[model samples]
Target chain A: MVEIQNTPPHADAEFHHHHAHATTSRHEHGHHLLQVSHLSVGFRMYDIDAPFLSAEQRTVNVIDDLSISVHEGEIVAVVGASGSGKTLLADCIMGLFEPNAEVRGEIWFDGEPMDAMDLAAARGHGISLVPQGVSHLNPLMRVGRQVDGFGYSRAEQTERTARRDKLFSRYGLAPEVAQLYPHELSGGMARRVLLCTALMDDPKLIIADEPTPGLDLDLAVAALDDFRSFADEGGGVLLITHDIELALRVADRVAVFKDGTVVEETAVANFASPDLLEHPFSRALWHALPEHGFSANDQDHPIPIQSTAFEQGGSSDGGDATC
Target chain B: MLEALSITFGYAKGDKPLYEDYSLEVAPGERVALVAPSGRGKTTLCRLLAGYERPWSGEVLCDGSPLPSSGTCPVQLIGQHPELAVDPRLRMEKTLAEAGDVSDELLAALGIRQEWMRRYPHELSGGELQRFCIARAVTCRPHYLIADEVSTMLDALTQAQIWHFLLNWQAESGAGLVLVSHSPALVERVATRKVLIG
Candidate 1:
């Protein structure tokens, strides 16, 4: 059984002040770019037997008591196995959860509680997403128009086109690619197009989900460098990926996700040694790294309910336990 | 042996050939990894090897003979996307049956549960579905198998598990294997020989 614990209010306040002060001076009171507190997501599914007759309902809790924060000028990479609720967390944050999903949590963006309208407006403006699937691109539209967000004004279209071309070149895509449809682009080109779409809007927070899957080594590194530079320019990034080594290169902090919730969030430096990471799952991931000889043998190991790291004040501000 | 002799391939009629005068050979009991950046026609090359697509020039040969045009291909190809490869209308068991007789031992080794056979392709996760696809390919007892980034989307543990099973199968059968992947580390660990392509 998993025990749920609420994060202390002071921890949230501390995270807010720490990150807000690090990037801008406009907000006098503590305000985090993104803060999620006591977030829990559960999907209600019908039982295998007697779907309509029985009143029995099964709730599979995908995320439980998870709290994470992203401050200005920080890249927090969430590393986890596939099917470990990583994508669900992103969907919940974007308010794009399925109709059957019951979410109970406090999600604050720019010091304001995010409702449905706020989340819808914040999407692609205040917060941009680099989705994992390249299929997100519209097959019917030209790559340039898709990246430009289909703007109408003549001057705005011209400016957006210039920006799109520059980004395409930076991503190693040819200028001629602008006129092509999504189906015409290669897998790598399509992925770069998605990245260009996310970067098209100068959002405060960027949520990149497995953005480097199909890319080669050099291009993957270049993409990570882009995110690093974006964070350096006072933008927050939530880099969700399966590639721990890639994430470690550009992330300031690393959050290890297990069965559902984040088991440990530590400074990137702590990843130098498995001993520095408090959670077993985090250590497993570290051991599974290619440089570490990929010695992780725990195929059926169950994820622990609570980690010593979390219990020992492993909140956003208190993440420097070993570092 | 599986051999591609001076093959030329391009998606379109007049487009610059993606592969111009490309030649490759794989002997029995050999594991050859094809390393290249994405969209460099790795999948296309695999399709050509498995006779899913014909080459514009030259020929693909198995054991010094051209690949049979019909019935029971000796070369099997497992694509990157398991969803696209499978039929959504059929159950998992039916899909596996199409490949020929599948041993329970093979299914067990690949971590394919018995209950999963009852479910449709859409009901399973990517990793789970991939296991079935791999099982289907190996169960056919092909002389050569081409796996195109088979476990790229899976978790580390699952990836390791699948590789372990495949390596074991290769050892037992002495079948030639062609692994197409972008992962340098995985290629270094698994491949006995490497083929670098742009």
Candidate 2:
């Protein structure tokens, strides 16, 4: 995996818009991997009234002047309330936005201007994205083949196979699952497969959009840990999530987006401070967190060996409170 | 009352059985929480209770009678992912309408607005969509509701509001609530009794 060293050129520094109010600017190594400047995406509507033509371009801006940077080897989590442009930002990053939607501003990778419509080009230059849904994989394709895409050389094959196993273990999945199709896998398994494919290319930056949106705590933590490991290993991670618990727990730095603007950005070291909860919106979000009876330590506690489905009466062991 | 007796089921080809033999009973107006590690059949049990799937063995009893497969059962199951619950092609209004008439009370209780009804699934946020899914689940007026992480995506305030609405609905309707969540605090707040699954 280390043989594919992505020494991509640094994008122009002018594209990064540093917020005047940003308190901490301690970025990880590697120059700005991606820089978005004065970017805004919107669409036109045919139903709008026009002077002559029946069709009109009604601009519904999904993301406005959304400038965020992911340096090499850093986990930057984009946290926001749902419908707050988090996914749209991710879509723009992945070049998956609709053609009808007019996208302004520039997305640069490795000091190169990224063509917004070309996912393959974006993917080739050390960039891969795992979508919100695991449906990114071809339903008919086996997980192994889905992850082990064709490349040019013998080394590429070896790398792909090695990376596949690494991902399977990193994501807490068994190697045998490589033979299963997307539909054959469980929700969690499907997600791991999507993540494996994203990591298979060893991209300089990996973007995960709500990677654990609806998963249980145990699974959510495990998924985040996998992403964190990637970041720890000199790779960049852009996490798009609405879950503050995850942002607080896993993100090294956080950017809060509201109505297409970056409302707040704080280092996770200071996440528990009153300043983090002081923002009205963040406060509203904080209060909504479940008072799950267990504390953070409890949340991370490893599952005991006794925890298995078979132990409980197949279907009839009436619900029991006893552990 | 909702009761399951020695239910056993697994995917047709899958060698691992999700439920070997599991039984659970929830009395009227009881709020039970089912907690377990991931992939431990918490969802399968909810499906059986909700009548979305049948148990390979044993029978599901609703109100002391065997649950009928053809019609809407007395139980509703809300999966962890709200996006999966709502059809992508349908608007929120139509999604709610599928349950029956959309009442203002239900809309307000869910913090959803009349304007939202016109929007598509892609337009709504994760939190809003989840609430809408919950409202739709209750549209048939099921006697028992199996909420599988309905509030998983929601922020704190919205979760509290939803919990309040659910508690009030349970009290007023005298319906049982079977909640599945990994959040211990959530279980504490809404679950009268907590059942831990492996």
Candidate 3:
């Protein structure tokens, strides 16, 4: 039998939102590996509430004026609450725009205007993205073929096969894993397979979105270490995740994303102490860590972030990132 | 009380048993954290407790009896991937209704907005989908709740919010909670007891 303690858990917790926004000015310096300026994405949707004959359409701004950069040989983590149009940012960079979407922004890759150089040609060639869900792996295809991409000629198939094997070995996957399907692999194996896919083409910049979700602590840390190794070898990484502690573990710099925009970008060194950080949002995140009382609100003031530990946040979940 | 009586199970016939004669017990108001690394059958154990899978031997009992084969089960399980729990074709309202009648107060506490009722699972974020899953699980009025890394994908603030709500719900309902988490800090903060599994 268990002891029954019916005391209301954290009854004193009542949240109220009143936070000051902080802004910083950034100038484009020389040339970085990847730089996005004033990037915004809005989807055009039919107004269901509007009269049918009129058929009014409205632009739902998912991301607005989002500016972030990833330099060669450095890992830049874009930390944000989940569901705030974070993945759309990744989609924009990859040129995977939704139908009826209006886009406005400046994206430069290797100092060249991304538009002038077809981003499609650049994607999977110079830039690779480890999508959030391992389910991105085609369920119908074999693991090796998916990692190797499509091959029409015999020689091309052979070359890609060699490359896939090399990547698999590097990631500690067995030779037989190539024959398996997505469902056949365990969670850790599936994640490693995702990493192998990202590394197949020797891409310079890798964008990993929420790659560590189902992984255990050791595997999660090892995944970050893999990114660290990639950076040490002159590659750049844009790791998008909601876990601040995990991001702080390996990222050299951090870009704090809120409401489809990056509110703060600071060095990881500043995270040792919350006082060194500039934005109030960043401080709120510091207070929300599992090790830090798992509470929300900074000094009884709430600004979109609410935790049951004190008051209610506008949303819930470390889930802010799960979005 | 919830009991796993000397359970033995495996995925395939030829393979060595994943769980052999493993037994455990949990009582109402007890928040038990099951600690183990990934691929260690933590998820399998949760599935067994919730009757998503059947054990090859032994049994899972609730209050000295087997779990109800139909109707609302006494054990409610919320897995890590909310995207998997929801049906892509169904609207949120329909899915929530499947669990029975969910009160507005419960929906409000979960931060589930009215506008979301008409939206399909794919239209909502993973967090929002998870909130729906939580609401659905609670609607069953379970005697025990098993959460398997439910908040692993969320941020710290969102994670805190989820655990806080879960703890409060447990207190109010006097239901047992079984949790699996990678974050030790979270486990320390929420669990009333720790049960290690390998």
Candidate 4:
């Protein structure tokens, strides 16, 4: 069910490049590239009596009072504990949600108002998603085909092939990897391919969810640097991760996510010290860094970024985790 | 001691061996870090030690005996992706049940909530799902544990919590550990001695 399918392009997946100015920027969050304001998402319980046949009963709010913005050429990181409903926000942006879900938000992207349909329609044109796990890659398809993505004419396919090869080579992945299945590829190679797929689209906004797990130090940093390059090219990124330290390295601003909502959104420079931070949990997260002694004094709220290095190795390449 | 004796390994389709004459040893209660840059065969070696994969020429022996082919293996492996190791259709509690008699203390230490048990693996985040895997493995009381990048995707706070519990568990159980980690800070704290694998 998780297999990659030949992706059919949305009816308007082409380069629209319109500002489509918002009649009412309700939150006054600036005319940023991506603005999410007062977003409230909840899941309704299925009717216990009717079960499969009935709709919602009670709404359990998952994300409430969430407001965040990403300006052009800026990477806004939404850092939170894993499973703290961060992906729900990305899902809201991407217009993916369960049938029993209740979502309420005013999202403006590229100066246009967005509901679920607008967000769904904007995918891969105005925005692209670098999804979390390698399983997002289609197992049956060749690495190159998936990276090129679906919905292209033969001529466009050929062009995508060329760009895919170029992107592959850029990541130090062998060009031959295009012909290989996902199972045949190593974990690191799979991650790079995922990143390459997001990069190939050249969308105005890229939302990457938990993208650094399988990478090595240099490669993880390299991936972050790639996002920087994307932002430098006048794009925007909503980088969602549990790694605050990694996020601090590249993000211009940080939005600390708590139980289903953002508790604080501040500049990365505020991480200079805990005193500069506004939230108690955010301060605890600062102290939780490995350099800060890896303390999880707040037992209920425990999460961290990566700093461990493989202290020894011979000459190395970045293609795979398994030889 | 757990020993990988003169192992020569290569994927069946590959033209060359990934590891040739590679030997390593871990005595009981020793926490060994397998450190290397990416694509250096660190994970492959983990597979060999845990009896998940067989070496072409050499053998993995534990306590002067070959690892058992069936039954509960003494070498329990906690792989990188917890989703891969769990069944999608089953609830979390059912999957944990497959591991047999998991203690309440183990559950509490990992910060696993009772509510989480009813959900499927896909419903939980990677960090939360991984806690179940660690609980299942540790409950077996294996003589050795192989942790391959166990906490890479987790937050620093959760990463610290998991490792703290692991180190304490290892000390109490005196189970040897063979781990692959990307964090030097973690390696500095967890590994007693590190083996470099290329």
The candidate that wins on DockQ is 3
How much of the real interface does each model capture, measured as fnat?
Answer: 0.15, 0.34, 0.50, 0.43
Highest lDDT against the true fold, candidate: 3
Models ranked on TM-score? 3, 1, 4, 2
Q: Sort the predicted structures by lDDT, highest score first.
A: 3, 4, 1, 2
lDDT of 1 at B4: 97
- lDDT tens readout by residue for model 4, B91-194: 88999998798888889888777667877776666777789999999988899999999988677677878888888899999999999988777788778899
What's the lDDT for all of these models?
0.74, 0.68, 0.77, 0.76
Candidate 3, which segments miss by more than 4 Å at Cα?
A: A1-30, A51-53, A132-134, A139-141, A151-169, A173-189, A298-323
- Deviation in Å, model 3, residue A286 alpha carbon: 1.5
Candidate 2 predicts chain B with a TM-score of 0.94
Per-candidate RMSD vs. true structure? 7.7, 10.7, 10.2, 10.3
* Candidate 2 deviant stretches above 4 angstroms: A1-31, A48-55, A106-120, A132-134, A151-193, A292-323, B6-17, B68-72, B83-91, B119-126, B155-157
lDDT of 3 at A318: 17
DockQ of each: 0.19, 0.28, 0.44, 0.30
Candidate 1 Cα deviation (angstroms), residue B174: 1.6
Alpha-carbon runs more than 4 Å astray in model 1:
A1-31, A51-55, A115-117, A148-180, A184-193, A199-201, A299-323
- lDDT score at residue B27, model 3, on the 0-100 scale: 94
Tens-place lDDT per residue, model 1, B1-198, is 999999999999988999989999999999999987766888899999999999999999998988899888899998877878899899899999998889988887786777668777655656667888999999888999999988776655566667777888999999999998767787888899999887
Q: Which structure is stronger by lDDT: 2 or 4? A: 4
